[model samples]
Target: MPKAKVGRKKAVLSGNHYTSRRFDVVAVGASAGGFHAIAELLGPLPANFTGSILVVQHLDPARKSLLADLLLRHTALHVKQAEHGEIMLPGVVYIAPPDEHMLAGPGKIQLAHTHLVRFSRPSIDLLFESVAGMYGSRSVGVILSGTLKDGSAGIRAIKEAGGVTLAQDPAEAEFKSMPQAAVATGCVDYTLPLNKLGITLKNLYEAGSPKSYG
Candidate 1:
Protein backbone atom coordinates (compact mmCIF):
# COMPACT_ATOMS: atom_id res chain seq x y z
CA MET A 1 0.00 0.00 0.00
CA PRO A 2 1.12 3.54 -0.76
CA LYS A 3 1.57 6.02 2.05
CA ALA A 4 -1.60 8.04 2.54
CA LYS A 5 -1.29 11.76 3.05
CA VAL A 6 -2.21 12.93 6.51
CA GLY A 7 -5.17 15.29 6.47
CA ARG A 8 -4.94 18.57 8.33
CA LYS A 9 -8.57 18.61 9.39
CA LYS A 10 -10.12 16.56 12.17
CA ALA A 11 -11.89 13.48 10.89
CA VAL A 12 -14.53 13.69 13.56
CA LEU A 13 -15.81 16.26 16.01
CA SER A 14 -17.68 15.40 19.17
CA GLY A 15 -20.82 17.19 20.32
CA ASN A 16 -18.88 18.52 23.27
CA HIS A 17 -16.42 21.18 22.15
CA TYR A 18 -14.32 20.92 25.29
CA THR A 19 -12.69 17.65 24.27
CA SER A 20 -9.52 17.72 22.21
CA ARG A 21 -9.34 14.07 21.32
CA ARG A 22 -7.65 13.34 18.00
CA PHE A 23 -8.24 9.74 17.04
CA ASP A 24 -11.67 8.26 16.42
CA VAL A 25 -10.91 4.56 16.37
CA VAL A 26 -8.39 2.15 17.87
CA ALA A 27 -7.85 -1.32 16.32
CA VAL A 28 -6.10 -4.10 18.27
CA GLY A 29 -5.00 -7.54 17.05
CA ALA A 30 -3.73 -10.55 18.93
CA SER A 31 -3.76 -14.36 18.97
CA ALA A 32 -2.09 -16.81 21.33
CA GLY A 33 -1.85 -15.74 24.97
CA GLY A 34 -3.62 -12.51 24.09
CA PHE A 35 -6.38 -12.74 26.68
CA HIS A 36 -4.23 -11.70 29.61
CA ALA A 37 -2.39 -9.10 27.62
CA ILE A 38 -5.62 -7.58 26.40
CA ALA A 39 -7.06 -7.56 29.88
CA GLU A 40 -4.01 -5.73 31.18
CA LEU A 41 -4.05 -3.27 28.29
CA LEU A 42 -7.69 -2.36 28.78
CA GLY A 43 -7.59 -2.19 32.57
CA PRO A 44 -6.18 1.31 32.92
CA LEU A 45 -8.27 3.24 30.43
CA PRO A 46 -10.75 5.68 31.88
CA ALA A 47 -14.43 5.08 31.33
CA ASN A 48 -14.71 8.25 29.28
CA PHE A 49 -12.00 7.40 26.77
CA THR A 50 -12.63 9.35 23.59
CA GLY A 51 -12.08 6.63 20.98
CA SER A 52 -13.83 3.41 20.05
CA ILE A 53 -11.76 0.25 20.51
CA LEU A 54 -12.12 -2.66 18.05
CA VAL A 55 -10.35 -5.92 18.76
CA VAL A 56 -9.58 -9.01 16.67
CA GLN A 57 -8.35 -11.95 18.65
CA HIS A 58 -8.01 -15.30 16.91
CA LEU A 59 -10.61 -17.72 18.19
CA ASP A 60 -12.11 -21.11 17.50
CA PRO A 61 -15.06 -20.91 15.17
CA ALA A 62 -16.52 -24.08 16.62
CA ARG A 63 -17.17 -22.53 20.01
CA LYS A 64 -18.89 -19.36 21.15
CA SER A 65 -16.57 -16.66 22.42
CA LEU A 66 -16.87 -15.17 25.87
CA LEU A 67 -14.33 -12.45 25.17
CA ALA A 68 -16.65 -9.60 25.95
CA ASP A 69 -17.76 -11.11 29.24
CA LEU A 70 -14.19 -11.94 30.20
CA LEU A 71 -12.91 -8.48 29.33
CA LEU A 72 -15.71 -6.78 31.21
CA ARG A 73 -13.89 -7.76 34.37
CA HIS A 74 -10.87 -5.73 33.34
CA THR A 75 -12.28 -2.42 32.10
CA ALA A 76 -15.03 0.05 32.78
CA LEU A 77 -15.82 0.48 29.12
CA HIS A 78 -18.81 -1.43 27.78
CA VAL A 79 -17.59 -4.57 26.06
CA LYS A 80 -19.58 -6.58 23.52
CA GLN A 81 -19.27 -8.67 20.43
CA ALA A 82 -19.54 -6.38 17.43
CA GLU A 83 -22.63 -6.71 15.30
CA HIS A 84 -22.97 -5.81 11.67
CA GLY A 85 -24.09 -2.25 10.90
CA GLU A 86 -23.78 -1.02 14.46
CA ILE A 87 -22.54 2.51 14.80
CA MET A 88 -19.16 2.76 16.42
CA LEU A 89 -19.29 4.52 19.75
CA PRO A 90 -16.67 6.28 21.82
CA GLY A 91 -15.47 4.53 24.97
CA VAL A 92 -16.93 1.17 23.91
CA VAL A 93 -14.88 -1.92 23.26
CA TYR A 94 -16.07 -4.14 20.38
CA ILE A 95 -14.69 -7.59 19.90
CA ALA A 96 -14.86 -9.44 16.58
CA PRO A 97 -17.21 -12.39 16.68
CA PRO A 98 -15.81 -15.82 16.17
CA ASP A 99 -15.28 -16.74 12.47
CA GLU A 100 -16.31 -13.35 11.21
CA HIS A 101 -14.05 -10.69 9.83
CA MET A 102 -14.81 -7.39 11.53
CA LEU A 103 -14.43 -4.23 9.50
CA ALA A 104 -14.79 -0.55 10.22
CA GLY A 105 -16.68 1.71 7.89
CA PRO A 106 -17.17 5.49 8.05
CA GLY A 107 -19.09 5.34 11.31
CA LYS A 108 -20.30 1.75 11.42
CA ILE A 109 -19.17 -1.80 12.04
CA GLN A 110 -19.30 -4.45 9.30
CA LEU A 111 -18.96 -8.20 9.51
CA ALA A 112 -17.93 -10.45 6.68
CA HIS A 113 -18.02 -14.23 6.35
CA THR A 114 -15.09 -14.22 4.01
CA HIS A 115 -12.34 -16.77 3.63
CA LEU A 116 -9.57 -16.75 6.16
CA VAL A 117 -6.31 -14.88 5.75
CA ARG A 118 -3.09 -16.12 7.24
CA PHE A 119 -5.09 -19.16 8.27
CA SER A 120 -7.22 -17.05 10.56
CA ARG A 121 -10.89 -16.33 9.94
CA PRO A 122 -10.99 -12.98 11.68
CA SER A 123 -7.82 -11.73 10.11
CA ILE A 124 -6.14 -8.89 11.94
CA ASP A 125 -4.82 -7.58 8.67
CA LEU A 126 -8.32 -7.19 7.26
CA LEU A 127 -9.63 -5.31 10.25
CA PHE A 128 -6.68 -2.93 10.42
CA GLU A 129 -6.69 -2.38 6.69
CA SER A 130 -10.34 -1.44 6.76
CA VAL A 131 -9.75 0.86 9.72
CA ALA A 132 -6.88 2.54 7.92
CA GLY A 133 -9.02 3.00 4.83
CA MET A 134 -11.99 4.37 6.71
CA TYR A 135 -10.35 6.58 9.35
CA GLY A 136 -6.98 7.36 7.79
CA SER A 137 -4.95 9.47 10.18
CA ARG A 138 -7.68 9.35 12.78
CA SER A 139 -7.02 5.74 13.73
CA VAL A 140 -4.67 3.70 15.88
CA GLY A 141 -3.45 0.13 15.36
CA VAL A 142 -1.99 -2.08 18.08
CA ILE A 143 -0.32 -5.51 17.93
CA LEU A 144 -0.30 -7.50 21.13
CA SER A 145 0.82 -10.98 22.29
CA GLY A 146 0.41 -13.73 19.71
CA THR A 147 2.27 -16.59 18.08
CA LEU A 148 2.30 -15.63 14.42
CA LYS A 149 2.92 -12.56 12.27
CA ASP A 150 -0.76 -11.91 11.58
CA GLY A 151 -0.65 -8.23 12.44
CA SER A 152 2.52 -7.26 10.58
CA ALA A 153 0.86 -6.30 7.31
CA GLY A 154 -2.02 -4.67 9.11
CA ILE A 155 0.25 -2.46 11.20
CA ARG A 156 2.09 -1.45 8.06
CA ALA A 157 -1.21 -0.61 6.43
CA ILE A 158 -2.04 1.67 9.33
CA LYS A 159 1.34 3.41 9.08
CA GLU A 160 0.94 3.80 5.34
CA ALA A 161 -2.41 5.42 5.97
CA GLY A 162 -0.92 7.96 8.40
CA GLY A 163 -2.40 6.23 11.45
CA VAL A 164 -0.48 5.61 14.66
CA THR A 165 0.81 2.08 15.26
CA LEU A 166 1.84 0.43 18.56
CA ALA A 167 3.32 -2.94 19.40
CA GLN A 168 3.78 -4.62 22.75
CA ASP A 169 7.44 -5.00 23.63
CA PRO A 170 8.34 -8.51 22.53
CA ALA A 171 10.37 -9.11 25.67
CA GLU A 172 7.28 -8.75 27.83
CA ALA A 173 4.85 -10.58 25.58
CA GLU A 174 3.97 -14.14 26.55
CA PHE A 175 3.97 -14.96 22.87
CA LYS A 176 6.46 -12.57 21.33
CA SER A 177 6.40 -13.56 17.69
CA MET A 178 3.43 -11.37 16.84
CA PRO A 179 4.75 -8.18 18.39
CA GLN A 180 8.24 -8.94 17.19
CA ALA A 181 7.00 -9.29 13.63
CA ALA A 182 5.07 -6.02 13.82
CA VAL A 183 8.13 -4.17 15.11
CA ALA A 184 10.32 -5.73 12.45
CA THR A 185 8.07 -4.16 9.83
CA GLY A 186 9.54 -0.80 10.91
CA CYS A 187 6.05 0.66 10.95
CA VAL A 188 5.26 0.63 14.65
CA ASP A 189 5.64 3.99 16.40
CA TYR A 190 5.66 2.68 19.97
CA THR A 191 6.96 -0.57 21.48
CA LEU A 192 5.58 -0.56 25.01
CA PRO A 193 5.08 -3.05 27.80
CA LEU A 194 1.47 -4.29 28.22
CA ASN A 195 1.09 -2.45 31.51
CA LYS A 196 1.68 0.91 29.84
CA LEU A 197 -0.58 0.60 26.79
CA GLY A 198 -3.81 1.78 28.41
CA ILE A 199 -2.25 4.90 29.91
CA THR A 200 -0.47 5.70 26.67
CA LEU A 201 -3.73 5.33 24.75
CA LYS A 202 -5.45 7.57 27.27
CA ASN A 203 -2.79 10.24 26.79
CA LEU A 204 -3.03 9.94 23.04
CA TYR A 205 -6.81 10.22 23.08
CA GLU A 206 -6.76 13.20 25.40
CA ALA A 207 -4.07 14.99 23.44
CA GLY A 208 -4.81 18.21 21.60
CA SER A 209 -5.71 18.54 17.92
CA PRO A 210 -4.51 16.22 15.20
CA LYS A 211 -1.50 18.35 14.42
CA SER A 212 -0.58 18.60 18.07
CA TYR A 213 -0.87 14.86 18.58
CA GLY A 214 1.11 14.05 15.46
Candidate 2:
Protein backbone atom coordinates (compact mmCIF):
# COMPACT_ATOMS: atom_id res chain seq x y z
CA MET A 1 0.00 0.00 0.00
CA PRO A 2 1.17 3.52 -0.80
CA LYS A 3 2.07 5.73 2.13
CA ALA A 4 -0.56 8.30 2.99
CA LYS A 5 0.47 11.93 3.44
CA VAL A 6 -0.67 14.10 6.34
CA GLY A 7 -0.80 17.85 6.56
CA ARG A 8 1.13 19.59 9.26
CA LYS A 9 -0.91 21.40 11.87
CA LYS A 10 0.07 25.00 12.54
CA ALA A 11 1.74 25.29 15.94
CA VAL A 12 0.08 27.52 18.49
CA LEU A 13 1.35 28.49 21.93
CA SER A 14 -0.07 26.00 24.38
CA GLY A 15 -0.83 26.48 28.06
CA ASN A 16 -3.94 26.51 30.19
CA HIS A 17 -3.70 30.27 30.58
CA TYR A 18 -2.89 30.85 26.93
CA THR A 19 -5.88 28.79 25.92
CA SER A 20 -8.19 30.78 28.19
CA ARG A 21 -6.82 34.25 27.52
CA ARG A 22 -7.70 35.99 24.26
CA PHE A 23 -7.35 39.42 22.61
CA ASP A 24 -8.96 38.57 19.33
CA VAL A 25 -11.49 41.25 18.50
CA VAL A 26 -10.91 44.99 17.94
CA ALA A 27 -13.79 47.44 17.48
CA VAL A 28 -13.28 51.04 16.30
CA GLY A 29 -15.66 53.98 16.06
CA ALA A 30 -15.15 57.31 14.31
CA SER A 31 -17.01 60.12 12.59
CA ALA A 32 -16.46 63.61 11.05
CA GLY A 33 -12.92 63.55 9.60
CA GLY A 34 -12.89 59.80 10.14
CA PHE A 35 -12.29 58.61 6.60
CA HIS A 36 -8.72 59.78 6.58
CA ALA A 37 -8.25 58.96 10.23
CA ILE A 38 -9.41 55.39 9.74
CA ALA A 39 -7.22 54.96 6.70
CA GLU A 40 -4.20 56.00 8.72
CA LEU A 41 -5.36 53.89 11.65
CA LEU A 42 -5.65 50.64 9.70
CA GLY A 43 -2.61 51.23 7.48
CA PRO A 44 -0.11 49.65 9.83
CA LEU A 45 -1.50 46.21 10.63
CA PRO A 46 0.91 43.45 9.57
CA ALA A 47 -0.48 40.91 7.13
CA ASN A 48 -0.32 38.05 9.61
CA PHE A 49 -2.23 39.69 12.44
CA THR A 50 -4.75 37.26 13.93
CA GLY A 51 -7.30 39.68 15.32
CA SER A 52 -10.46 40.57 13.44
CA ILE A 53 -11.20 44.31 13.23
CA LEU A 54 -14.67 45.84 13.00
CA VAL A 55 -15.17 49.56 12.38
CA VAL A 56 -18.02 52.03 12.39
CA GLN A 57 -17.35 55.31 10.59
CA HIS A 58 -20.45 57.46 10.34
CA LEU A 59 -21.54 58.00 6.76
CA ASP A 60 -24.30 59.65 4.80
CA PRO A 61 -27.04 57.07 4.43
CA ALA A 62 -28.39 58.73 1.32
CA ARG A 63 -25.07 58.34 -0.45
CA LYS A 64 -23.07 55.29 -1.42
CA SER A 65 -20.19 54.37 0.86
CA LEU A 66 -16.83 54.06 -0.85
CA LEU A 67 -15.10 53.49 2.49
CA ALA A 68 -14.20 49.86 1.98
CA ASP A 69 -12.92 50.56 -1.51
CA LEU A 70 -10.94 53.53 -0.38
CA LEU A 71 -9.35 51.65 2.50
CA LEU A 72 -8.45 48.61 0.38
CA ARG A 73 -5.98 50.81 -1.45
CA HIS A 74 -3.85 51.52 1.62
CA THR A 75 -3.79 48.46 3.87
CA ALA A 76 -2.81 44.80 3.86
CA LEU A 77 -6.03 43.74 5.57
CA HIS A 78 -9.02 42.63 3.51
CA VAL A 79 -11.64 45.38 3.77
CA LYS A 80 -15.33 45.14 3.07
CA GLN A 81 -18.72 46.39 4.12
CA ALA A 82 -20.20 44.15 6.81
CA GLU A 83 -22.85 41.68 5.65
CA HIS A 84 -25.59 40.06 7.72
CA GLY A 85 -24.67 36.66 9.16
CA GLU A 86 -21.09 36.97 7.93
CA ILE A 87 -18.43 35.39 10.08
CA MET A 88 -15.59 37.75 11.00
CA LEU A 89 -12.06 36.61 10.15
CA PRO A 90 -8.61 37.45 11.37
CA GLY A 91 -6.67 40.03 9.38
CA VAL A 92 -9.86 41.33 7.80
CA VAL A 93 -11.55 44.66 8.41
CA TYR A 94 -15.32 45.07 8.26
CA ILE A 95 -16.97 48.47 7.95
CA ALA A 96 -20.57 49.20 8.70
CA PRO A 97 -22.65 49.90 5.64
CA PRO A 98 -24.39 53.24 5.30
CA ASP A 99 -27.81 53.38 6.98
CA GLU A 100 -27.47 49.93 8.55
CA HIS A 101 -26.50 49.27 12.13
CA MET A 102 -23.90 46.49 12.32
CA LEU A 103 -23.42 44.34 15.39
CA ALA A 104 -21.11 41.63 16.59
CA GLY A 105 -22.65 38.44 17.94
CA PRO A 106 -21.10 35.29 19.35
CA GLY A 107 -19.56 34.15 16.09
CA LYS A 108 -21.34 36.11 13.39
CA ILE A 109 -22.37 39.61 12.35
CA GLN A 110 -25.87 41.05 12.50
CA LEU A 111 -26.95 44.00 10.35
CA ALA A 112 -30.12 45.94 11.06
CA HIS A 113 -32.02 48.95 9.80
CA THR A 114 -33.11 49.87 13.26
CA HIS A 115 -34.00 53.27 14.66
CA LEU A 116 -31.34 55.95 14.69
CA VAL A 117 -29.31 56.01 17.85
CA ARG A 118 -27.92 59.34 18.97
CA PHE A 119 -29.19 60.63 15.61
CA SER A 120 -27.09 58.24 13.59
CA ARG A 121 -28.19 55.06 11.86
CA PRO A 122 -24.94 53.17 12.21
CA SER A 123 -24.41 54.23 15.80
CA ILE A 124 -20.96 53.76 17.31
CA ASP A 125 -22.59 52.99 20.65
CA LEU A 126 -24.67 50.21 19.14
CA LEU A 127 -21.65 48.46 17.65
CA PHE A 128 -19.37 48.88 20.66
CA GLU A 129 -21.99 47.67 23.09
CA SER A 130 -22.58 44.52 21.08
CA VAL A 131 -18.86 43.83 20.73
CA ALA A 132 -18.35 44.31 24.47
CA GLY A 133 -21.12 41.85 25.31
CA MET A 134 -19.75 39.25 22.92
CA TYR A 135 -15.98 39.44 23.38
CA GLY A 136 -15.64 40.88 26.92
CA SER A 137 -11.97 41.20 27.93
CA ARG A 138 -10.84 39.90 24.57
CA SER A 139 -12.17 42.97 22.82
CA VAL A 140 -10.40 46.29 22.10
CA GLY A 141 -12.38 49.47 21.67
CA VAL A 142 -10.84 52.48 19.88
CA ILE A 143 -12.39 55.89 19.48
CA LEU A 144 -11.00 58.10 16.74
CA SER A 145 -11.50 61.65 15.46
CA GLY A 146 -15.13 62.74 15.21
CA THR A 147 -17.78 65.16 16.39
CA LEU A 148 -20.52 65.07 19.02
CA LYS A 149 -20.47 62.32 21.68
CA ASP A 150 -20.99 59.20 19.61
CA GLY A 151 -18.23 56.98 20.92
CA SER A 152 -18.17 57.99 24.60
CA ALA A 153 -20.90 55.63 25.76
CA GLY A 154 -19.53 52.86 23.58
CA ILE A 155 -16.05 53.05 25.06
CA ARG A 156 -17.57 53.10 28.52
CA ALA A 157 -19.48 49.95 27.68
CA ILE A 158 -16.24 48.32 26.57
CA LYS A 159 -14.50 49.25 29.82
CA GLU A 160 -17.36 47.92 31.88
CA ALA A 161 -16.98 44.64 30.03
CA GLY A 162 -13.31 44.42 31.01
CA GLY A 163 -12.10 45.21 27.51
CA VAL A 164 -9.18 47.51 26.70
CA THR A 165 -10.33 50.91 25.54
CA LEU A 166 -8.38 53.60 23.62
CA ALA A 167 -8.91 57.03 22.19
CA GLN A 168 -6.95 59.04 19.68
CA ASP A 169 -5.21 61.98 21.33
CA PRO A 170 -7.67 64.83 21.16
CA ALA A 171 -4.92 67.32 20.39
CA GLU A 172 -3.92 65.30 17.37
CA ALA A 173 -7.39 64.73 16.01
CA GLU A 174 -8.81 66.83 13.21
CA PHE A 175 -12.10 66.85 15.06
CA LYS A 176 -11.41 66.61 18.78
CA SER A 177 -14.93 66.32 20.13
CA MET A 178 -15.29 62.59 19.78
CA PRO A 179 -11.93 61.66 21.23
CA GLN A 180 -12.30 64.29 23.92
CA ALA A 181 -15.66 62.92 24.93
CA ALA A 182 -14.29 59.41 25.09
CA VAL A 183 -11.33 60.53 27.20
CA ALA A 184 -13.57 62.46 29.53
CA THR A 185 -15.43 59.28 30.41
CA GLY A 186 -12.28 58.04 32.22
CA CYS A 187 -12.79 54.61 30.69
CA VAL A 188 -9.97 54.66 28.18
CA ASP A 189 -6.74 52.84 28.93
CA TYR A 190 -4.67 54.72 26.40
CA THR A 191 -4.90 58.09 24.71
CA LEU A 192 -2.36 58.04 21.92
CA PRO A 193 -1.46 59.85 18.77
CA LEU A 194 -2.78 58.45 15.49
CA ASN A 195 0.69 57.37 14.43
CA LYS A 196 1.34 55.48 17.64
CA LEU A 197 -1.97 53.65 18.02
CA GLY A 198 -1.09 50.75 15.70
CA ILE A 199 2.26 50.04 17.31
CA THR A 200 0.68 50.17 20.75
CA LEU A 201 -1.96 47.66 19.73
CA LYS A 202 0.69 45.41 18.24
CA ASN A 203 2.60 45.45 21.50
CA LEU A 204 -0.51 44.58 23.51
CA TYR A 205 -1.42 41.73 21.19
CA GLU A 206 2.14 40.40 21.31
CA ALA A 207 2.24 40.42 25.11
CA GLY A 208 0.88 36.86 24.94
CA SER A 209 -2.82 36.45 25.61
CA PRO A 210 -4.04 39.31 27.74
CA LYS A 211 -6.12 38.06 30.69
CA SER A 212 -6.95 41.43 32.09
CA TYR A 213 -7.10 45.02 30.80
CA GLY A 214 -4.78 45.90 33.69
Each candidate's number of clashing pairs is 0, 0
* Residue-wise C-alpha lDDT for candidate 2, range 69-181, written one tens digit per residue: 99999888899999999988888899999999999987678999989999998999999999999989889999999999998999999999988887888888999999999
Quote the lDDT for 114 in model 2: 88
TM-score (C-alpha) between model 2 and the true structure: 0.87
TM-score, cand. 1: 0.87
Cα-based lDDT for every prediction: 0.84, 0.82
TM-score versus the correct structure, for each prediction:
0.87, 0.87
For candidate 2, the clash count comes to 0
